[model samples]
Target: MSMTNRLKVDRRDGKLVMAHFYVAFISLAIGGLAGLLQVLVRSGMFVLPAGIGYYQLLTLHGVVLALVLTTYFIMGFQIAAVSRTSGTLTSKQRKIGWTGFVIMTIGTILAAVMILLNEATVLYTFYAPLQAHSIFYIGLTLVIVGSWLGSAVILLKYRQWRKENHKQTSPLITFMAVVNSIMWIVATIGVAATVLLQLLPWSLGLVETINVGVSRTLFWYFGHPLVYFWLLPAYMAWYVIIPKIIGAKIFSDSLARFSFILFLLFSIPVGFHHQLMEPGIDASWKFIQVVLTFLVIIPSLMTAFSLFATFESYGRSKGAKGLFGWFKKLPWKDARFVVPFIGMVAFIPGGAGGIINASNQMNQVVHNTIWVTGHFHLTVATAVLLTFFGISYWLIPHLTGRTLTKAMNNLAITQGILWAVGMTFMSGAMHAAGLLGAPRRSSFSEYGGASIAAEWIPYQVAQAVGGSILFLSIILMLYIIINLAFFAPKGEQDFPIGEIAETAEKTPKILENWKIWIGITVLLILFAYTIPFIDMFHHAPPGSKGYKLW
Candidate 1:
């Protein structure tokens, strides 16, 4: 068995992975604090002291948690998974890994420092016309560029593995990492183009005006896939790690690979669904992209089905009977299983909400409302973020040469429960207020004491209540992580990677054909966006100069 399959990452490699978790955990602390402040301000029950601006906090929270935390964690997690499943990186590959880590850390610090100075108030979306400082844009560009460098390490390692083991399947976790890396490289081209060509020039004052429609077009093009970038890693945990934690096998390796392929093919071409309400784009193109957007539901549902199967199969093997009895057979006491399980259950509703947002008519109802905010909170915050926490519970200890003691496991479970409870209060209120016409991205207001505005106040307070609980959870999370990293008893905690079940069919060779998959992914992107991309220039109104309202 490989060293990784034997439940330990090489010590040299562990340091690299630990570096990433450090940044990710720090981001959680900074971002989580900003989030609490935002909620408090929105509730109209508190006021900012001195010169602190609401949008500044909003920008900090969005960029740090959404972009910084997710990217660092994913990159680190993928690197470690690839190293474990494939083999420890060679000295050259390890050097490349450290290089990427350095560049990414530099970029993160630059961007974060700018935000702290209040020079950049643009939120995570980086939407145009709401301009931030040139350094901020440059910093973010470096962040993207640094990630590309990190992705290169994964590709190089995978290529090396392929050369060494001809006619053999790649390790499952390593293969999934490659798929995600390829998708990210392809998807970020849109954002990179806009940043290097348009936004950078404009923000630097070399250009007087910026094209809003075209910029937004490029952003959402990258934006929607950006969602999957965050999601696919969580899916990785669900498909590979969760089953192992429960002592079950993967229901089907082929199903898992196919689902990931479907994600790569269908995820990028559907960004137009986000632009349905915007003008200057043809309705026909929007309709096409919307249809493509719905196609994404297939792989998502496949994942759901596969997880259910894994659970059911394991339960049956353990003597579970009746239709729903299998659910009772899961390891409820295991923090590794239970923490991610909450995230899985949260995705059911989180995903349904996504389908609604994609529908054109439905998009109009929720677009830019607190409903949209609420929707993502459930999806990314509860569904995605909580799972990251769960992964950390095991991963941090695993890398640090320690084990999860029962007391710490209990605390980890409490952290997840707190997150769920907090999100319910916060996101549920935001959804309700949104349906009643509360706009998002605005500070507390009675709108000249308007009757309609009065109705949203209660919901705002509820969000504050939830936000407070979430902050408490964050504190607990950090404490638990510190313990795991430094104070845990010296022992081995298994790095769980699920094995394929005996009855599973052989994975078809076609699934690994990168030429065919990338060819299709590229073609679909062109089909969905080529015309709109060109037409945006022709149909766009005059561009606007940068604004700094904050």
Candidate 2:
């Protein structure tokens, strides 16, 4: 069956997908505005309104963009991918998805209202000792639960398909979607435990104190994998969609599946790398996690190799000559291709920064600094955000039955470039300032005219400029998306699925052995975390009472 036919049959599912995107874009707009405010305030160029504190805005920005926008957008994209690849969802699955969306939406509203009211100034991490209203924690918990429910719908559908087609392999996109959903379901367990068992009770006065170390451990357990949760969707685009856009085939489907499996296995067990700078965790345990962190990089390297091979093969087939001719031969004109391609390139530095952060010694140098901020910006901001932007160029139109006009396409290209340029200035400055001992999560001017502080001023100014540009770019993106959703001419859109170059190289059935993979994943997590957590609880210090700093 054709992708068009699949999409036509699932047109009803489009409403659910559209709801998710709408929430995502709305979060992006507000979060982006808050980002601009952060830079301005941090640079000493602008003061916020009287009732709106800087911390409040920071919390709002982080939660909305990192938690809300990414979660909603990823869920929406995966739903569309599954429906388009596998088949239309059953009514039950649709209901489950809508239930999750509604719950998540309510959670977002509760969290946003608390942030706006200056009641929940705890940053996205919501780390212990810095408490917020119980509603804030409850709201975040709902968001996680809602996403799990949505993922359950995808998982159920995938299982149903497998049962019906006993011998057939799932479509690459559908398989990837299901794998990601499972990973999410597994990853959120740590956070859910922390929120439901620890923070929620403490916040609600049911408990007077909470174990800070355990709370942080639980959060990082979920935190590092959360990055991969954001990343895999982008990887899906790179491995599956970009190849089609570039008139190439996936270099190796089996290798791609292996990469996802590797990610699923390795992504969770390495979260201790984030806590290397903190005490209570054993150094030996941290070292082990650092090694595991390097291990996880294998899948990404495999992906990079696969992408390059695809590009080279396609370029050579198109009559390109010379060592790097293939690089030049890529479809640079298509906004859909260029945006994600640039995003992948940005990951080179982003991934490198990640390695630095994962290292115990190196992390001591950059931890809690603006360097960490720069690292994630390169990752989630450029790599993930840009790829999503690329997807949105076609996705919105595909769901809405609208034509993505040439002007809008051109504008998207412009938006991508602007984002790149702006990030270059902002993240570059952040990296430089962090190296010079600049702190992160600070609202005040650091230097106060001291010579050491004076050194960071230029970088601060550059960040402000970069942030302003980014704000404008997002506005342009929202304009394009709104037009695509509402005012564009109606038409059928193409859903491109890449072919595999090697027809003879079938993906191994073992690659799809969920039981084996999940078992291994559980064992690895137990190996990595069991000792540290046991030690934490056994010799745990008296819990700390919550503090409301603001």
Candidate 3:
């Protein structure tokens, strides 16, 4: 589906996505600094100056990077993907896009101010019984709602394309954007419900106490799928864009769509795996959700196989021989490929760690441990972040009428390598220390000189070292992004979208049947949750009053 006509995101559509990217990049800087500070403080090598709290920085780091940055970038990327594949959005669609961006930006600001003021240091999850200010909850509500508006833009574009094309398979990228949007809309309902019906009123003093179990259950309902929300965009690039970048066709359009639909089904109904140890949820339900969680591994493995096949086919075309010779035929020099390729490798270990987290017995060992921190650092921070960065290598320049010159591409590749090395040290240390029983979500201490606490100190120092390297990599990334966005030479940068392989079977029309897929997704969610939710509410204790922990 690579456009041959001066391939680029249309300038007007470019502006819309760029608006979101500006905020996302700004968030990278703020959140990156906060992360660095956190690691340093945790290492006992530095203390926050007077009045600056460790947990406060931790909260800002989590919320800004995880929520603000990811949300903004995913929206921008999805919009760009759709516009590049389907024709440019109608002017009204762009207007709606901008409105959503403005609303989300305002909400981000509101939430940031509350966090900075230390009124909402309840951590990123904003877990109940540890309440934040009413304004904070309101800001959160706005963010979720605004994201819905953003999701609407994708649906509208896909709908318009279907209306115009009449039963044709939608552009693959556009179809992907729609899948992500629909998945997001369905998943966010849980968080939206918690914020509006529970947290908002409770914070406003309309309610005297909160149901911790129900609130947590709702959050995890949204939480695990939230991981998928962050992931699927990178998968979009991997399945669609990477083949084009490597000068080959996609392995199978049908397989790609099937994997996506599988993700949609399996990503939900599995949130309970995150709450495996939490009380008030029946053991049977947790076991059910855990089974559901393992089902996600199917689609994940499908994606892995697809990439392997794509790579091998590309290699054979280039005259490579032998089983592993295909690996040597890859584009090691292109920043757009190299950077995201690193992310793919990171996901190997990251995915393995996730499997452990999903298992009830294994989750107990690592639950609330810094190992969980290490896990997400690999998955989200390294894998997802690097892939997004890779997308920017071309996407930013493409949007800005600029070319990613050789120098900038080199810098981008360097940035990715630095991130990998840093993550290895930081995340590896975290996992090791967690196995030694170091707790997560806490500041550095020697536990009143207890001998066991001493075991964690070396790992803490290692984390600080890793964090410092990551900050340097962040600087490189920002520099590359700035150059691409503003100062690179003017040229057309092709937005790559792989064509379906000639031998591949036609994509089944049923894959695009939104009603059947979404209906099944809803059913799976209900099947997984109804019994557990009923149990949570029926046996609920008198809710506890909010605490301002910070």
Candidate 4:
């Protein structure tokens, strides 16, 4: 059957997907504005208005953009991808999705209100002994719960499809989506345990103090994988959508599935790499996690190879002349391809920084520094955000029956370039300044006018300029999306789903063995975390009293 026919049958699911995108864009607007304020404040060029402070804005920016925007967008994108590739969601599944969305939206509103009112300046991590209102933690808990519910729905549909199809391999997009959902469920258990068992009780005064080290351990347990959660949806586009956009098939279906499975197993256990700088965690355990972190990189490397091969083969098929000449044969003018391609390029540095941060020796130099900030911007901000922006150009039009105009397409390409240029200036300066001992999460000027402090001023100025450019780029992007959603002419659009290349071997049956993969993932997590967690509880210091520095 045609995609249009399938979409017609799944019209209700499309509306749910649109709702998710709507919320995501709203988050981008609010968070993007907060980002501008942050750069200006950090540059020491502009003071915040009365009743608004740096930490508050920082918390708002982190929560909205990092947590809210990524979660909503991924859910929407995954649902759409699954529906398009597998089959329409059942009415029950749609209801489950909507229920989760409503719960999450309410939770976000409650948490956002707390932040805006200066009652929750704990930052997105919300680590103790810095405390916020009980409602703040409660709201975030609800958000996690909602997401879990939604994930359950997706899993149910996937299981149903497997039952009906019997021995057939799952559709690649659907397979990827299910893997991500399972990963999310596994990852969130850490945060949920910490919040419901530790933080929430303390916040509600049911407990007198909080286990600062234990809470942080749990947070990071979820924290690093949280990045992977944000990233995998973008990977879905790169693997499945980008090849199609480039007039090529996926290089290897088996490899793509294996990579996601690797992510499922390796992504969570590596969170201890984030805690290398902290005490209480043993060095041996940290070293083990560092090794696991490197293991996770293998899948990404495989993806890189596969993508390059796809491009090379496609170029050769198109009659390209030389080794590097194939680069020019790519569909660069297509915003759908160019935007995400740039995002993929940005990940080169971002992934490199991640490796540095994971290393025990190198992390000391960059931990709590602006270098970490630069690293994430290159990653989540540029790589992940730009991919979503690229996806949006087609996704919005696809769902809304709107034609993406040529002018809007050009504007999107321009937006992607501006973002890349801006991030280069901003993150590059941040990295340089961090190397010279500049701190992150501060809004200070002139470290008492020390000579070394003076060295940071030029980089700070560059950060401000770059941030302004990024803000402007986001504004243009929003304008384009708004037009596409509400004002563009109604029309049908192709939803790109790359095929497996004819030259590639059939996907291995071992790749589809979910039972084995899940078991191995569970075992790895147990091996990595069980002993450390037991040690933490057994030897833990007295819980710390809460503080409200803001």
lDDT of 2 at 287: 92
Candidates' C-alpha lDDT: 0.88, 0.89, 0.90, 0.88
List the candidates' TM-scores in order.
0.97, 0.97, 0.97, 0.97
Instruction: Please write out the lDDT profile of model 3 over residues 1-550, one tens digit for every residue.
Output: 2231225677888999999999999999999999999999888878798798788899999999999999999999999998888878788888989989988988899999999999999998999778889989889988988999899998998888888789788888788889889889998999999999989988888877767787888898899999999999999999999999999899999999999999999998898899888878888899999999999999999999999999999999999999899899999999999999999999999999999999999999999999999999999998899999999999998899889899998888889999999999999999999999999988785352668878999999999999999999999989988898988898888888888999999899999998999999999998999988787677765444322323
* lDDT (Cα, tens digit) per residue for candidate 2, span 440-550: 877645455676777788889999999999998999999999999999999987777787886539888998889999999999999999999888777665443322322
Each model's number of backbone clashes?
Answer: 0, 0, 0, 0
Mark the regions of model 1 whose C-alpha exceeds 4 Å error after superposition. 1-6, 446-448, 540-550
Candidate 2 C-alpha error for residue 329, in Å: 1.9
lDDT-best of 2 and 3: 3
Model 2 residue 379 distance off true place after TM-score fit, in angstroms: 0.2
Candidate 2 regions with alpha-carbon error over 4 angstroms: 1-9, 446-451, 542-550
